[model samples]
Target: MADDLGDEWWESQPAAAGSPGVLAANANSSDALCGPSKTWIWTELNQRASSLQKPSGDEEGRDTEMMQQDTAPVPEPSQETKQPMECFLTQAKETKEETRKTKKWKKKKISEILAKSEPKPGTPGDLQQLIKDHYSGSRSVIELEELNLPDSCFLKANDLTHSLSSYLKEICPKWVKLRKTHSEKKSVLMLIMCSSAVRALELIRSLTAFKGDAKVMKLFAKHIKVREQVKFLENRVIHLGVGTPGRIKELVKQDGLNLNPLKFLVFDWNWRDQKLRRMMDIPEIRKEVFELLDMGVFSLCKSESLKLGLF
Candidate 1:
């Protein structure tokens, strides 16, 4: 059966044209904790391909004729024909000018988006203010619930002074000593939470410099099952775990994840998805994240053992 399906069989089958394939793919990509996540690159590629597409023969033929008329003198025509030809030339020139302006505007918009994508360092105070602003317009009574916690719960900002590996060393100076002394097989010393499995995977790759000999596991719900994660946690001495909020919440609820051993809880806080929305901006994900914090991390905050980092 595996041989028959061949490679790439498990990937999502793209829907037919005129279908909601792009929208559907984007929706799943955002909540990829439970499924494979695809990037918005496909949509970008499609848009590029469309822009590069050659105009139809009708339009091309008109352009060619217009060029020839402009370059070569034509025999004098009747008054009626001359007026329409002049109008046609004027319309064509206007269309060309409009197209040029459209392209220029698009380029400017793309640059603006790229600039906005850059990660800016923020203090714990900034994070608190952002939370307050996000919920300031509480239209309903239920939305009035306080999501922001005390300032002591948050660690200092990354400050862009060091690479992720070096930052980890600076923050957790005794990591080497703790790693050796830790004996729990079912708990992680550090847990990094992100918005999606795709980001989690990226974080795992970045951990190469920091992980060293310590075991790092991806705890998202993409291809792995809850039971499988439970077994891995029970059998292996995991030092780090990277996952999304929903799956992490589920694991903790099932007693598969132990927060007692967690010393550092990092949020992939500054990163934004293609839609320019942060993890907390997404309604479902925001709820799960707050819920996860309420589960056990809030209690751990009282002790000096657990420190929260906004990465």
Candidate 2:
């Protein structure tokens, strides 16, 4: 029965040579049957896939060229071109340093100039010599004028008088006691010293002790009585002259007078002369005289004393 069924199936299958189904199956299987055809199909598929996947050698080469162009080297600046800039910077630095140094030097010089400058005549020692000479009876009126004091001398002279007067008032009792008990010769010497001191004091007073705005003439008038006495005493000594020391000694013994009066008298006489006046009027001389008077009478009087001993 199986053999009979097999025989029936075989009869139902069509023959391969003339059947359309058989032809269609053969065409579908042609790639597997032909090696060259299969190889050609694979090569064409790979070519198309590679074209879609990545860049070719030509495109890669173009990309490489662009990268190289982007990274091109820039030239460095030449030393010759940079030299001028460097030099200019150096020169500017040096110029600033030099300017700083110059300013420092100028400041130093100015400080030195000011430091070395002289003090004004109104300061100490201004009238030291004038006071000394006036008291010691050594300086003549001409010599006083020649001294060329500053205006400050007069101001200081006034100060000296005020100071001395205060001192005298404080010691007046002692002076009076000394006057009464002392030998005539000793008394005379003391008196001379005292009188000279007082005259110096008076000179200073005359200069500084006045009220404001008075005329020179009126001022002179105010002190006229004492001034005349001073003048008279000065004239007496001048008339006696230095050669008449004996006469001067006798006169001192008799009158308790001192050489101070003569000295001041001489100074005044010389000072008041037209010639001395003209000289004193000169700005330079006037300044000098003022300075001399400001040094204080006591200081100048001491100097005159030394000169007197020498003479």
Candidate 3:
């Protein structure tokens, strides 16, 4: 009966909400045995604490699944999330291409403007500039009034009459008689400097206006070698030498074209080449011209025998 009462007392006691796994005792342990009863109650409390400390099987499985979910790897970004960045990169590339195109168009526009602003040859202003550029390397460009050149040597007013026949009549009216004498001496009496073979041929054809003109010889480096022409001039009585400065120099070096009776130095001065450059404006042609001047051609000018005429 006492044990039963003690048991009933323990069962009737309520646990406090504030403290879990805690035990409380009533003051009614006076009827119970001290040692064993206290031991039994403490043993019961320890068993309850142990039972509460361990979880049920279902609870353990749920906790394990939650931990696995937390530790799982984070997945890579989806295509949807990356779309904005890819679109940004594509737009940046297109913008750069447009910028490059704009710069190229600007460069082309600037080049066209420069080409239009630059001067072309044949105008009066361009002719003045051409003359200036031609004699830029010369020591002096003043008119040679001290020379007192003969009227028959050069055309008056520094004009070639704008045509070959007119030019012939103006400066070389007695060319037929003069060439006859030069033919007997087997010497070149005149050197007509042209820009190219085409111009040289044109002038040669124009001399046929009289239908019985003197013999003419081509001294250019087209369809023939310079050395071969030098060999031919030795046997031929060439009265007029027509060619570019380059081929004429080869003849002078080989002592083929005799300059003894040579008195007139005619230049195709008004003609501009493809690049709008005159004969003296070109470096190689100008250098060859200076070389020809050094080869006893200018000695005639010093002796008042040679005269310059623009044709």
lDDT of 2 by residue, 1-311 (tens): 65867677754565444345544554576656767776675465456556756789999999999999999887887766557888999999999999999888874433355368831212234334534454447667776565543433222222222343343333232433433343322112111111122233443444332212211111121233434433445343221121112223343434534433222211221112222232223444444334433433334444453111110
Q: Compute the lDDT for candidate 1.
A: 0.77
Each model's lDDT: 0.77, 0.38, 0.67
Q: Evaluate model 3: give its TM-score.
A: 0.52
TM-score of candidate 2 versus the correct structure, residues matched by position: 0.23
| lDDT per residue (tens digit) for residues 1-311 in model 1 | 66777767646465543345654655566665343224455556466556556577889999999999899976796666457788899999999999999888874443476587965675677656655665567535454344546667777668766666777777778887888888898899998889999999888888787777888899899989999999989888888889999999999999988898899998777677887677866888887876787687767876656888977
Off by over 4 Å in 2: 1-62, 69-71, 75-164, 167-286, 290-311
Q: What ordering of candidates by TM-score runs from best to worst?
A: 1, 3, 2
Clash statistics: count for each candidate: 0, 30, 0
- TM-score: which candidate is best? 1
Candidate 1 Cα errors over 4 Å, as ranges: 1-119, 129-150
User: Model 3, residue 263: displacement in angstroms?
Assistant: 2.3
Question: Which candidate, 1 or 2, has the higher lDDT?
Answer: 1
C-alpha lDDT of candidate 2 relative to the true structure:
0.38
Top-scoring candidate (lDDT): 1
What is the per-residue lDDT of model 3 for residues 1-311, given as tens digits with 9 covering 90 to 100? 75867667756666742235244342344355477777776677667766677888999999999999999999987776557888999999999999999888874443465478853323333333443555466635463222223444334333423575676556667877776666544367677787789878987887676325566789798898977887777777777777899988888787777676786777766666666666766778777876786687555666767766665
